[model samples]
Target chain A: MPKILIVDDDPNIRQYLAALFEDHGYLTVVARDVAEALQTAQDERPDLITLDLDLPGEWGPRFYRALSQEPELKSTPIIVISAMPGSRYAIGNAVASFTKPFDREELLKTVGETLDL
Target chain B: MAKTVLLLEADSSHADALKIYLGRKQAEVHVAATDEKARGLLASRDFDILLGNPYGFGEACPGEVKRHKLANPLLQVIIFCPRALMDQAMDDFGPLAANYLDLPLNSKALGLALDHAEKCIATEKKLAAYSQRLSDLHDAQSLYQQLFNEVPCYITVQNKDLRITDTNAKFKRDFGHEVGGFCYEIYKHRSSPCPECPVAKTFYDGGSHGTEEVVTSKAGKQYNVITQTAPIKDENGQITQVMEMSTNITQIRQLQDHLSSLGLMLGSMSHGIKGMLTALDGSIYQLETGLQKEDRTRMAAACEQIKEMTERIKKMVLDILYYAKSRELQYALTDVRELAETVVSMISPQARHKGINLVTELEKDLGIIEMDPNWMQAALINFLDNAVDACLFDPKEKEHRVVFRVSPRDPETVCFVIEDNGTGMDRQTRETLFTLFFSSKGSQGTGLGLFIANHVVQQHGGSITIRSELGEGSRFEVCLPRVKTDHARLNAVPQPHQNVAF
Candidate 1:
């Protein structure tokens, strides 16, 4: 099964995305902010990661830069999810961008295509 | 100097004798043997003196003297008459007669009278010149007065101590006619001189300076004036006073403010609208996917999401509408205690969701107040919402609570107090809390909530005040009069671009 990482500040949004991916036969791990996302990415080495731009403390773009520096996680695909418009440029290596409240099927499809499901 | 004289004598011997005697004294004499000839000579040239024999001319001598005096008021007349008629001729001519000499033909007396007549003529010419000069000076003084009073600007002369030494008619009528009053006291009602005052600068540098200031009249009317100040120096070149000239520019400032406010409204609303559209897109995606899968439960969830998002969009649209709409207020009598309870109940659900307690301590006898219910409710809700948001944003590990209290502040005023033990604002945020488009909450706030709330309170002829310190809490007090008056409504109408404080 493909393992996925969800990074969002809102608990409801994180839970909903996790359930959507788990229902598609993928193992999902959730992180509330940039710090938790970085810790989870290093530990789980997920196939794909969903990032939210507006986070507490360090933001999603800063986390993306730090995550890109990690040699083991450099190849992992990142899908940008934000409430901010035109936030696709937040991460240069983002596979796709989704604005909240995001399209459930579109997000699932993007994740599947990124992980080659 | 040769003096010109008109001699009216019916006897040629007497005329020739006087003429020969006057000729030796450098006199140019014209002798008329008849009354008609004397009238003809008087009309032909301006004579310095008229030496006439009234006995020869009969009763017409007084009439001729009156005519000549009317033509040239400075023309001196000497009437040679019998001693019995001397008093009568003097009475008829009044001040026009220089002398009434008895006609005995004494050459020495005649010579003395001629010299006296010449002296009178010289004095009359000097008096006429002095009268003309005086009238000219009067005209110049009147023109100066008109320029000072009727120039359509406020003019004030202040001494070195900032006391108003003099003011023009326009300044007296618009401000007050109080001389020897402090300029700041009369102009702005301030106890001290304003900081960096233009008048003070002119006095310091002895140069002209200009600045824009808001001046208030004695009756509390405000005016935006562009004021220029210049020094009034003494004869020794020492600055003794400063002259302040101000032109009112309230209307132009109002137009500029209105335009900028419209721009601010447009710029601030764009982000929230974009977020709402994206949320609507999400709901549509859910509906389409649920329909494709043919799942009843998923379709029901999608319908609920659509309904929820639609409500949010409607609220956002109404918020914008409320900020932009300028409408007449509809006032009704309302109970203060009941109003406080209703506001607390309305916001209690959100407070409970965040594990925060919402409490109300309303006085029993708050009484009924005349106000617009809709606007008052909106303002109260905004305060409650802000209190809740402050709590939600606090990262402290403690329980949050908000108190809504209503009490009578005085005989005439009723106050609504909202206190929250949440994340308090710093001084900078508190200072600009009521200004347009100033928001502390990024993305989540439209920055119009408090501004509109303050507007609603002012519309009701009330005031709002805020007290906050960092990490402590915030207290908002809205004081309103118990009885509404027409004067209050008239005074409360928001002026365009006026920076209104609670």
Candidate 2:
């Protein structure tokens, strides 16, 4: 089974996305902010990562940069999800970007394709 | 007029003869025989001409003539002397005397000398008057120059060729004091004249003209100026030069820009707000369905979503309140039914244009409510406008209608209800409807209308509630107290989000 990392500042959003992916039979790991996201990515080495742009202390872009620097985690696929408008172009290396209140079917489909690749 | 003359002589017969001859010539002659009498006469009376026998009066005559000349610089004096004594007389009194005669005076020569003295006095008086007038003109010119320089506005005098002839101190300070420079070059840094220049218009029509212009200074700073130009005509009544005066309005323009950009900032912020609303809606949808399924794990997860969305909404509302606190409300005792009728009249035309049926149902004698009529009217307009937009956005094939109704809830409260048969909101939308920046119209909505409408109603000590279904319609009820209440007490009412229910 493929494992997914959910990174968001909102605990509820993290929980909601975790439940959504877990219902689809993908194992889910959650991080409440950018700092924890970095630590979780190294420990779990998930197949894909879902990121929220706005986070406490550090933002998602800085975390993506740090994650890309790690030799072992450099190839992990990232899907950006944010409440900020025009945050689709926020990360250059992310495989896909989805705005907040995104369709659940679309998000799950993008996740499936990214992990398959 | 007879000319007055004083004659000094020691010989009595000669003095009497001379006085008779002068009197016949239209002269008033006063004879002073002794030096003492002559001195007295000279002191007491004004004489146009003085004739003295210097030999008879001895050395005192020359001294007396000098004294008379000192008293009246324009006085004319004639002395009688023998040819042998002429040289000595000329040495002592020549500068003071108008003329000199031989010891026995020739009457014709004496008359000629008196005529010359009268002409000298007339010229002196005329010269004095001309000098006084010249001094007055100089003073007036100085005053004009001072006023031109001290005026607070920039002023410049330009000739027919558009070259600056003169500039006031203020203009000189802003644009360097270079006379004969081209007006356009100095004022606007342009090589050629500006189009529709007020100064050029004044020159062509010979009438005053006014315009607004943005001017750049030598220091490279910009100023918004209102310029007025008038013709400066020459003595021939021809327009010779144009005088332009300008007042700076840079700060006022800056204030207007600041206000407009504030409006723009509010517009841009709506996009971020719309995204947040969508997220909240998604969360709520998950929560309600989880409850229906009775899944414990899903219910726990939905509870977390509820808490997070609630906190974000609270912060957004507080931010809106802080921004709107500056606008003071004007309150009056307004008839609720009349206000509703007025709003309907105002919006009916637009509703008809959109092919939506707008109807009003008012409860007669629905008494007055103390409220800000303008703000309350705006709230009604906002609700009606949303109703119209909802109808337009609806994709259904059914007949669309929006009805505005007003009635007394009780003796003390009035309720305004608006119902629209359009694309209504779902449970998730209804739950977060009154939260700031939540709009179903997507990019077309600023997300501020309903937020502002809710705020206005809240200020009137009123409450707003909505009931809707996904495809059927939505109904909004605004209940306001008819009697006046202390604004402080109204503010004490809990925030709107707490009162809203799904």
lDDT of 1 by residue, A1-117 (tens): 989998876544564576567767999998866788999999998999998886744578999999989999988899998877788887888999987666777888888787884
Question: Native contacts recovered, in order, as a fraction for each?
Answer: 0.13, 0.24
Tens digits of per-residue lDDT for model 1 on B420-493? Answer: 99889899889998887666554445678888888888877799989998788899999988887654565554
Off by over 4 Å in 2: A1-117, B1-18, B21-47, B51-61, B67-71, B251-502
TM-scores of chain B, in order = 0.81, 0.52
lDDT of 2 by residue, B46-135 (tens): 887788776677566677678778888766788887888889888988678878888678888877877877887688778878889889
- Tell me each candidate's RMSD, in Å, in order: 5.4, 20.8
Q: Residue B377, candidate 1: how far off, in angstroms?
A: 1.9
Q: Return the top candidate by TM-score.
A: 1
Worst 10 residues of 1 chain B by lDDT: B493-502
